[model samples]
Target: MNDQLLSARDLKVSFDLPGGRQAQAVAGVNLDIAPGEIVALAGESGCGKSTLARTMLALEDATDGSITFGGKSLPKSTKKLRAFRKQVQLVLQDPTGALNPRHTVYDAVAEGLRIHGIEGSNEYDQVISALSQAGLRPPEQYLNRYPYELSGGQRQRVVIAGALALDPQLIIADEPVASLDASVRGEILALFQRLRDDFGLGALVVTHDLGLAWNIADRIAVMYLGRIVEQGPVEQVLLDPQHPYTRALVSVLPDSPVGDPQVLTGEAPDASQIPSGCRFHPRCPLVASGKAAEAGIEEKCRTQDLAVLDADPRNWQSACHYSAQFGRDEVRGTAEPVADSLG
Candidate 1:
């Protein structure tokens, strides 16, 4: 944590909603990305992972808390911020929409360089190197190609190449592989890994896929209802999830070791009208199945609002009140009958 390339402390982002209410998009998130480390922010769609990513990129401002990159607070001046952005690049999902259809691969790759006024006799060389680094081998072959000309994977690589051309230290990829085919998803994920291994590039991959996190991330942070409910090493958190939300997500994975899949009832609550106490209590499997009452934490679970997880980033933490009790038989469904199974 001391050597974190980018860190967000108690970060919060909110937006004005209809009526007099506000949507809490990101609420009190503490995250760190060390040099060369890959951290995946895993969650469902409405959990605010993308908002957190955008906040880190300075595309969205935090309503509270602080964000520091390279051990310094984010710059305020436009000139300074522009320089800061050169070090932190964003790779968005959907390469098709990301790229300019009329632009050639060369143009797409060189666009950032041009924007940052990085022209020189070797600008062309920089584009080629970036393209090659992104795994578009023998880069020259693809330079004249348009976005429509390349396959989905190739188009994604071009998007990555554009980011790499700026020589960024960190990449904040928002669902980078969401639009790709299954075969191409691995290749793109592998490309991200190679970037880290080869260049010591740190990345925060925002995703809803726990499987993707298990495959590519060094650490995983499970986000729910605008907060990180569980976080630790990829194996520790995913294999022995202490938070019910995390457990539910891991259980649905194809290779989940946590017994049967749990079908959480109802949709995620609207951010504008978040539930009191535990924001996830309404959809929590344990609450619906009577396990919480059986364990005598139902009242506390329903009425006590939990704070952020423990401040220590090195240790695994879960915000649930009875996280320690999660080791009980109920997790594996071996105990006597509860009221009903998860919907």
Candidate 2:
């Protein structure tokens, strides 16, 4: 059997806009997670990071492409899909919204087991074990608590425990730490790492925080305007990014010292109005000229979209006109250096 736990190929997700236009939230994205790997998907809001996570969980329909778990294509029938869900689970950004206000922490965590008909004398034991794994100590103390009674971090842990109750092989965590306090976020991240180590759970963590990605992810996939601009081993992509967008992202990270102020300017482009050549040309510092320039090398970036090109044999890939030209020097900015603050 293949060791890959999950594989997504050219996954595309689009939504109908106000008019007749359709916004492509995820466009031809590809990714794979080994049995226990933690792959971080990083990008700003509206970059389709969340949409990608939902698509992977089968929460959203795909416009095209395929997703596979444990060497099997995702089920097409509703019943099969429902059965497939038992093997995959999701943890959202806001745990309060995920848990029912009417349900106690124990009920919330046990819901999956009930639905899967996994009841017995050990059901409560399983629930407690999952809670303990999530660091919700004194599981009995949290058993009767409702969503409102728990702190944000505790509630998030409850949500994670619910996912764990299913004993899923893969977990899609969309901004799992986005709502927690800084102090608690590390504990949660450590919990995820421990879960992976102990239970061999594969996780796809979607977040906008590069620091979080740097701290917990084994690999990093940088997305921009609905496409993966760069991806590779965490150290390779974080310390020596090859794509201009990836370089810019690493430079703006609070832990890294800023190199050039120009790299921080501009924002991601609108999906409907993507630049002619490259979706990120408007914000690309290596384009040779500003957005106003209609001629020269800048025009290439504006008119020519690039494909993901292999940068190394370790599965490192990037999509940029001059990905090979990027290096660590770009992140060594002379601007106001920010302290290594965890967000």
Q: What does candidate 2's lDDT look like per residue over 1-343, in tens digits?
A: 2667777787888888887888888877878788888999998888998888888878899999888888799888988987788888888899889999999999999999998889788899999999998889989999999999999999999999999988888888999998889999998999999999999888999999888998899998999988888898887677666677776777766555435423546667667665677787767766544422432355566677676433232677777655433333432333443444323
Candidate 1 lDDT at 86 equals 92
Residue 219 in model 2: shift from native, Å? 0.1
In the range 229-266, model 1's lDDT, one tens digit per residue, is 98998877777777889888877876566767788999
Model 1 residue 90 lDDT?
A: 94
Instruction: Name the 10 consecutive residues with the lowest summed lDDT in model 2.
Output: 325-334
**Model 1, runs deviating above 4 Å:** 325-343
Root mean square deviation (Cα) for candidate 2: 3.5
